[model samples]
Target: MNLFERLSGVIKEELTSLVNQSIRQEDTPEEEIERTISQMRSKVMATRIAIVRSSASQARLLKKGLVILEEELAQAEAKREALLRRISQANQRLERATRPTQTPFYKLEEKALELEAIAQAADELNWTKKINS
Candidate 1:
């Protein structure tokens, strides 16, 4: 049998033995015996109710623990996302500073700026030559 079943049988035997020992006196009246049994039954019922309430209290505590763990997991995930975003930003900044020639966009921008500076210089030379003439 399961441990709970064995434990229940043991408890039943002990309670019955105690009740029998308490009421076994030959001088005890029949009505008094009946009253004693009723009171014992009430006490047993109260004990059962207390056990159920204790189990419910434990269940509530377990549920609260689960909620706390879920909240912690969400916070950890948010931290992981933030860390990844920071790493990506840092990598982009490093690439721009150290490897501009390796990136096509930076290379094109640099070429455009150089060409604009050359055009401006040529325009200035033409303006000066016109003034001289």
Candidate 2:
């Protein structure tokens, strides 16, 4: 991966090197100037293409990450709603005060809150990523 990025830099440097050598060795200044300008234009265009391609790849990866994040978020939301219903039932049971086996809503509520926190974090991360990409 690093090698691929470094190759772009290497290509740019090679183009500069060749242009400098041509400038020093050519008999006619006009010919050297024209050749160097052509080489520079090609290098600039190639760099732009490379940048666009990298941006496209990053966009694809970010989109895939968002898809996975969305599916996980949907599941988290479903779990939260189920827990809310259970908590409501527990409250109703508390009103009757028939059983003393466990704490009514604390544990389930705890897990629901934890999942909510994780979902929020994932959402923030995804937003930042998408904007940057």
Candidate 3:
């Protein structure tokens, strides 16, 4: 072979070797980047799942609290109704007790006069008996 052809062949071989080495170096970093991205995606998915579970647990607790409050409200309403009924009954009794009687003033005066006359007659009879004995 001529000197020029041999030199060209050697140059081509060196360039090919440099290209292959650079490609290998680039491939390793690309694969590492892909693995890091996959790890980040998995971590994000796990965080989202935890948030969803926490939200669900809080919702259940809130629902239970609401139910308890509703029951308490119902009981309070019942107690208030009973108190109102008792107040109504007390008011009725007070009205009846305070109402005026049907008896007239002239009838009471006549009863007093009759009682006084009976007392006077009994005293006179006892005095007469004592004097005779």
Candidate 4:
């Protein structure tokens, strides 16, 4: 009876150990699944953060580029205006250079009368009498 009691005690201990090991095995898969889910959540959060930061950086760069484009547009407008003014000035100079110089009719008539009076005075002078003699 003593030997039988010892054998029964050993068998009971072995069954208990196997039951505990099976429970641990079952709980291990659940723990590993939970850990995997947590790691995935962390990766998703990190990706979202990176995307947000990249978007902000891209926005800043685009804003800077817009500013530069506006400045260039302003400069281009100023240069265009300056070129137009210069072209207008050059056209005015060209028109003036190509214009014909015209003397007034009144000035020509006055000069003709003055020449006739000088000729008449020269004919009455003794200088013409000596030349004719």
- Put down candidate 1 lDDT per residue, 1-133, tens digits, no spaces: 3335534765786688678867777544444545545544544454444344445665455455445545655565566567668989999999888864657898889899999999999999999999999
Write model 3 residue lDDT over 1-133, tens digit each, in one string. Answer: 3334533654675577557666774555445445444444443443344344445665455455445545655565566567668989999999999976657786787788999999999999999999999
Pairs in steric clash, model 3: none
Candidate 4, residues 1-133: lDDT per residue as tens digits? 2334533654675577557666774565446545444444443443344344445665455455445545655565566567668989999999999875556886788789999999989878968799899
Tell me the tens digit of each residue's lDDT in model 2 across 1-133.
3336645675678877877785775456445545545554554454444445566665455455445645555565566567668989999988878654355587777778999999999999999999999
Full candidate order by lDDT, most accurate first: 2, 1, 3, 4
User: Cα RMSD (Å) between model 1 and the true structure?
Assistant: 27.6
Better of 1 and 4 by lDDT: 1
In candidate 2, the residue pairs with backbone N, CA or C atoms under 3 Å apart (3 or more residues apart, or in different chains) clash, namely none
Per-prediction TM-score to the true structure, in the order listed: 0.34, 0.31, 0.36, 0.35
Candidate with top lDDT is: 2
- Computed on alpha carbons, the lDDT of every model, listed in order, comes to 0.63, 0.64, 0.60, 0.59
* Regions of candidate 2 where Cα sits further than 4 Å from its true position: 1-54, 97-133
Colliding residue pairs in candidate 4: none
Clashes of each: 0, 0, 0, 0
